[model samples]
Target chain A: MSLDIFKERGTPLDRQSFTWKDMVGEPYSKLDDDAFTRVRQILMHGVEQESCRFKHFAARFNPELRLPLARIRRVEHHQATMVNWLMPGDQSTLETTIGFEQVAIEVTAHVAAVEPDPYMAQIYRFGLLEDFDHLYRYAALMDRLCGKDANNILQSYTDVMPGRPTSVEHRAPEDDLRLHYQKTRAAPLTKIHAALITGSEWQTRDYYLTVGPTFADPIARQLYAEIASIEEQHVTQYEALSDPSETWLEKWLVQEATEVYAYWSCYSQEQNPRIKLIWERFLSYELEHLRLVRELMQKLENRDPAELLPAEFPDPLSFTSHRKFVRETLAAEVDLRARGYDIVPMDQDSPASIAYRAQLNAGGSPSEAVAAGYHWRPGTELTDRRVRDAAFAPLSGQEAAQ
Target chain B: MNKNDRPTDIGINRTGIALSPLDGPLTAEGASAAPPSSAGSWQDAAMVRLRYAAEASEFGHMPPPATLRGLAKTAKELLKGHKANVLLDKLGERLAFERTGVRLYDGLIVKFEANGSWEGGPTLEELVAFRSDEARHFELMVQALVKLGADPTAMTPSADITAVESLGVLQVISDPRTGLAHALHAQQIAELADVAGWDLLASLSETLGHTELAAECRRALAQENLHAAAVARWLKAHAEVAARGELEQAVAS
Candidate 1:
């Protein structure tokens, strides 16, 4: 559906309410449903999460927009709950961690492929490789820690291989920032991508911070710490990608339009009928939300919301696997490193980053420890019957005793 | 810091209302005096549960047979009374349980190292031996599933639920703050459940006429009972030491 954000009057904010039963509805199946279903759910949950977070922060700053912001934020809180609670209880923390990484890898690939600006696309691909490497590391953790195949969670949708070595992805704080888009000249989609991806990484960083300590394994704990740091860096880069010069209302306007785009994307491609209806219903709710925010923008600052939104939304973010694009990106840019808003060859990495990473790795890296000589076998290391990753091979009673 | 401080040495654990004195009694009185928020019984929640339960789908389905020989075995079993997947799914449950069971012991082993054991509690060798048994049993379950033409790697619905249940067992054992006895208490819970699981699994196997598999399950069951007994003895001994002699000193503020 070609949705003109400015023209479509979405479901009224008053009607966007939810019941206790409705908000805590049935979760999507981890086994039966497509992996991309979880992807859409996780990303959109992040999107709504950001919506609530942005409004809270915006309310602290904008005294005039506070009430409408809270009105929209209230609906958004329910929206976040509805989306996040859709993850089935059966998916373990590590298993769900795999799903989160899949979102990063796949969604970033799509954004990178479609992002028009060369530098922005390069940044997306660079971050893409780092997250790609994360899936491989977490896949290793799932195998080495639990003896389960990551593919079971993956359902063969996303590949489990290193893109950029996560061990090397760490950098000094300054290197993590990127050049923001020229807000006036940048495509509306560019602003949308920045908001969406930044929201995703922000939620991811917070998730890892929350769940990291729940793990008992020092390896799992440290891997989360390590990767969550990169997620922080990701939030930094993606958040910086947006021009900071835009007004509070302008940013808020863009946020609402992005939600319209995201829900449209999910509604367009969702396969499960029950979940599809949610995306469809929420799409209407978000349309109304966009309208509410647009009205607020007009009244509060007399700004034209149309200037922030495109006449038509860009192509709905593709929810399909970009295995080919990912592999191609890996081959072409595995050695690329971030050096203060510039993507460069590994040899050109900033010395400050090298020093920072060296101090962090002085003790030894958990990502390397968990995946030592590890490969993604179809069945986990345990299932290979002929030869197992001897590191995890079963010990006889006497051997264990010794 | 008390040089003689032990995990079981009770300090200021102010959880119970008796410790809270005035506020605790007042809180209890207030709760009893409070009117109901809504006009309904507990069945209100039950009805909600029932509605959701009726609407809910199966946690998951069994995958197709990975091998033709096992497929033939499953087909033959289907010619009789029971569904083949039922047996396969239970076996998969045990496979997952035993796999996680190994990790539980791995965590306990680290606990054994970090906080040394008591007079009657576990030894390093005992922890290692138990872990080995779990690993070997996991291997046995995997082979049994393969023999039944089921893919061992695929998590059956039962396997998924069992993993969900193990999460709590895992949490207790993995927690460093938990005492060695506390960790054993957690494992003993698994052991009790493991004993029942193996017994039921064996009986099911026999009823289904899988005699060889039943025999192997009985062997694992016998081993599980031993583990449970050993854990019980150790816990009892550790508790008796605290309760009999040092009981006052342990609790004294």
Candidate 2:
């Protein structure tokens, strides 16, 4: 049966009717493989959607509204936590960490390809490499800690090779704000893409923030802390692409609509019965959220909610192997750095040079340190030299520097 | 189009009221006064229409207003019943596993297509279907994570296991030196292990009060069992082919 998200509003359970006991969802161990994948997609979409939604509200000039918006974000965060903890008991933390990097790699690559704005696409590619490097770094840890190869978790789909070495990923925060898109002229997909990516990067930052402290290995903890900082920069770079001129109400409407669109997309594509039901249910919930935002817009500004968004869904975001796209991008753009909207080749002497100095000043980069630790103990470096060499071949003098 | 007609009068019939004057000569003084009718150009008119068309296109992509109202009502009810369930570690593992599954299938598809048809073995169509199923599994796992309000990108232990296991298969598939036989052997091994893993997960989920999840595992287990069996059959058939060729060579000698 065709499920119409617009018409199918779910009945939200009453607060008094349910206790804290009801808040705890059924913790399942084995989801059907298809079902589990759907769940992950929906959750990833929600995490990004909610974060973008919260950011829009939080950016409002009105101080009085901040508290309410923050509360909403907190609830969303609670929801995100629930979605995150659905991992089976058999999986390890290191294994999951690899999964996170894979998401960053694959999802970023997917978004980059479809991203309408060239500037935004550039940023996606730039971060794609660092995350690629991160996968290698963490894979090394997986090997050291568990005596397992990184390829096992990656399923050998993503190459466990360096992109742009994470050692050079550091840059001045001032350089982070490269360029912004004009909101009025930008495509709806562009806005959603920015929001989606910003949300994903922000969540990654937060994940590292919480998980970094729990690591017993000093180097591992340091690695988390270091990578987390890069995520922070990634968040900065991606969020900068958002049009700051957008009104909070407009952003809110877009967020709700995006959530609906994402859920609907998942529901449409879902083959598994149980997961499809969840997608339908959530699509209904998000539709309700969109309705409330529309009302607030009508009441507050008397503006039509229809004006803010389009009548049909934009292109759906699909997570697939971007191995070829990523490899090509790595070959071409590995040595480039963002200077405002323009991506220029890296030049240590150029006035625009911020990353090189930033890297040198940050002391011994934890990224390199992790690699060194692996080398010192295991008698091998983290990445496959062949893959690493090929990816960096375009960068002149990179071999000597390494 | 008479010269006497105001520039604004030209396209006024086609495009409603002109926001800016359509036609006038520009002088330094005129820049401040009515902008010297810069808006009267056909280019300007076309741009205006284009903007309208863009806005119209935007509307096409959005959900209808009625749907929004329905969603808002549902959201209000949900807010009242909102409660958080914390299951941090397990969700992390599941997310990792599904993510790995996606990459695994992706690599396999690439390998299968690049290698072309396996001699007297499973067709590319069959491989594509298997890859699609893996993609579907990845999507379901992602949805489950989202429903629970968790971040699927977070690092977890199970992901490490998935990465390591998938890596072995990837190594065989990605290397040019390895052929379909090696790939099939790798697939058989992977599928067998997958079935065992799913079986264990299914029982564990049942014990943990996740009957739905257990059922899901059983479904995956069934698929894995088929996959393993197919690979085994293909391997046997290939071996027979080799044996027959060797026998013919001996007879000729």
Candidate 3:
């Protein structure tokens, strides 16, 4: 069929299904409790997956996620494009440590979820890669903006006491969750610690809307606005999963209580002073956000702001009945293949190498790779040409060059 | 002279020095096989005539004289009825001043005929010069709507902001050449076609200020869309080709 006919006939993919919101100009005070919760959940989920990736990267390479404090500097236009300009002094610190971590988590999730469609996979991967680039840029900017050791925490996490692998084989979800409990449960047990990485993301929609462009430098402001648009799409997606008819008061009370408790619990047991600071800052931001939401809601629904206060601070965390699976293989000493490296992390029976192996297995045919929406890494074509030229003389350029 | 005279007397007519008998049998028995002057150019003229007739019939007639008089009564409210013309002239002026842009309203009946809506509606021009500017506007609009706590997709203008409404007028305006000449001067359209051809070029150039790479890319992508439509003509002309799949695979690879 003609692309036009196909485009015309094909139903537009549900933006709500993709976790986007429709453009409604009404203040967020309109969202119901369930909708708010759903939005929060989605946001938190994005953050959670993002944090997971950050953890892996930190564990593997002690790259600085933030710039040191001594490098305090003025913000640039481009930097402000993506960063929330409304955020004032010391935002560089926040961006490096928290924002970078969040971005990593988001990038990883994108890779896992969005890079499967043959047509869009490359663009999505590029998006994730762009996120990665943004992550490093933000970290560097933080370094320049503040003169603190942005890498200090990560360095310690990697160098001071690297955690030992407890499993031999690739672990399943049940095993992974169980192991998380076994290893980190005793290390810290706060409702907030678990919930810090939990919750939905609808608030950022409001947060960016409320704050981003105000302080963002020109380019950064533009970038934030664009991203905020995408975030609005995110909000819509969350709303679709929940009821919209519920009152805004209920949603705010529930979400605020949950978020507040989660932060309280996480901060209480956090060993790193920086993490505590982050928790406090995030809480402050959330409080302001909650305040704005309440005001907007009151104006729209003619309700009292005081009436929006919660019954009691919610519990720090609610434990899920999530299970962790056991790994079937053990870690082994990997031979570095003529490089003389003695030991390295070995991929036993895990899907650690799934994507990479997929690439390798699908190599040797550019057409096949194109069919799979995979581009050959730079220089692969040259390598293939060199090998082929050694085999075929007619097509070789050596004769022509001579 | 003898040959010319014999042929001229025999019912041949040659006006130019280079003119010659068709070098084939020209008899009542063979006339069925002979081509006519109306075979090519005449046929095109006929088609053009038919098309205009159909367009006229489809549109029917202009609003009654009374309605137009009523419109004139509230002329000031409608910017003296000159706003339309002024807006069009302003838009045309912008295109005219651009380094590489075409005025959509200028020249030819088909140009006006195809984009007839442009005649009555507010005139707008796209500055196809820069892809960034074009992209930036949509992005800005989308972003601004989201920041207002509005859904970008849900952005149906309940009421028109005068400026935004004006912008919308320009948005719908298109070049006349591509819009109406598809049937009338089909061969001319084909000959004038480059990668984007003259119509898209003119439209994009008139609309956007720059011929940004994105516009080019978009145009190429559009051509890909057009290629499928042109398949029958392509296949008929190229008898040496294999099946459709082979053709597509060759192009795809």
Candidate 4:
């Protein structure tokens, strides 16, 4: 059923009423494996919801909305963290890491396939390969450091193979910016897609930034640092797609509407009752947020709130595997590089080539170290020989010229 | 509460009055009377009335106002309460979960292939890549279990739970009537959960001082976050297309 977020009244808690102890709810364990999906539903709902909320807030000039928005944001932020942290104490970090990559590989492939904007799709595809390569690198590290096969965590669903070699993932910062979509002409899905991806990539970049330094192993730390930099590039690429013309008020309205859409999607699709409750409640909260923002828009901008969104809520987002799409993209576009507002073959030079040179000048590249660490390993290479050979064919020619 | 009256010092300031000096006007007349200045833009008084209704209502149960600091504390508590053997058992469950993922993707690939090409749906080749990734994950989980001195194939409680949980997903995909859209919805749910599961597992391993394992999980976590992003985007795009089609049909009729 479609959630009329404008009409729904939400559960309102006193600001900062709950303490840390209250927030620490029971986590799911192996016995609760079925519930993990529910947990994911709840967490994703919060993540997507907050992303919409934040985009709106980022555009606001009113210092008055700031305090309330900040409070709401804080609560939403906590909810996301709680949802993510709900795993039982026994799950290994490495195992969960595999799950992370699995999500990345499958999700990216699906998004790229469905992306309406060709340029946006290209960005997704490019980032997909880098993440694909990361899975391979981490799998190698897992095997060497802990005597674990990458397949153990991955369940062999995703091939632990190289996409774009991490060694070459580094590029000039300018290369990250692609052609921007016109805010007025861009599909609502396109706008949301940019917002959604930016949030996730930023999360990954921040995660690596925070967690990379804590690793005891020098190589592991280096790998994270290298991949983390690429995530930064990804954030840059995805965020650049958003139209700069959107007013704070316009953005706020969309954010609220997007949250309602996401929560409604999760609430409807969720199988588990307990998790459904979370989705339902949060959906209500977002509806309230949407209503408030809509009112704010009406009072301030004099534009109908309904005009900011589609007549109906768009389809709910899902996370299914799209192996064929990824494989095709990998084969076809694995050698492509981001040029200004367009993609070009890796062999072709771009204006950002100077940025690459500057990056090289900064010594001790982590991606190279990770690549060097795994080059000698016999069977651990995740990429199939044919795909790997094809991807690196141009690079070999470059080497020959040198 | 009067506009001037402020709430007592709680964890976060919740006074009805605007906290910042830059706050334009709390009153409707004050706001509408003033010319539309860019710097003086604020929420409408009517919007504030809505906030008051939410804040004053006592009938419904709202989620706790959880702050980042509160969550951090909760995480620390969780880590403090963790045990090693329990972690190992969870790892076994994770293995089983990955195995189930492998099977689910395998089934999806077959379905995609058999169905042939659709207008906007993912190609069969994309399904293959996803399936391969799941298979790789399954193998990785198995190896992790072995390294931890656990039998991945053995029927442990966690393993059993994993199997049962995945079975529900497989059941949906296996049904002949399940459309591509429905199948994708189910898969998206699974991927979302999988990402969270990994996040928790990574944190747990880190807390238990499994540095190497934690690092590996962090690497994997980054990718899963991307996966979640991609699937969400696809679902939205798919829905929008469907919605537009429905609109077109209605107009044509």
- Best-matching candidate per lDDT: 1
Instruction: Give the CAPRI class of candidate 4.
Output: incorrect
Candidate 4 true-interface contact recovery: 0.00
TM-score of each: 0.63, 0.52, 0.21, 0.53
Model 4, residue B168: distance off in Å is 33
Model 3 spans > 4 angstroms off: A1-222, A245-253, A272-402, B1-253
Return the lDDT, model 1, position B140. 100
Q: Considering summed lDDT, which 10 consecutive residues are worst modelled in model 3 chain A?
A: A321-330
lDDT of 4 by residue, A149-203 (tens): 5443333245555567776777787777877788777777777666666666676
Question: In candidate 4, what are the lDDT values of residues B62-167, reduced to their tens digit?
Answer: 1222232433443444333326456766676667777777777776765555443233446666667666766666676677655554456665566666565665
Instruction: Write one digit per residue (lDDT tens) for candidate 1, span A241-264.
Output: 999999988898889888989999
TM-score sort, best first: 1, 4, 2, 3
lDDT of 3 by residue, A179-215 (tens): 1122111112122222232222333444556555443
DockQ category of candidate 3: incorrect
> Which has the higher TM-score value, candidate number 1 or candidate number 3?
1
Name the docking class for model 1.
Answer: incorrect
DockQ of each: 0.01, 0.01, 0.01, 0.01
Candidate 2 CAPRI-style tier: incorrect
lDDT of 2: 0.58
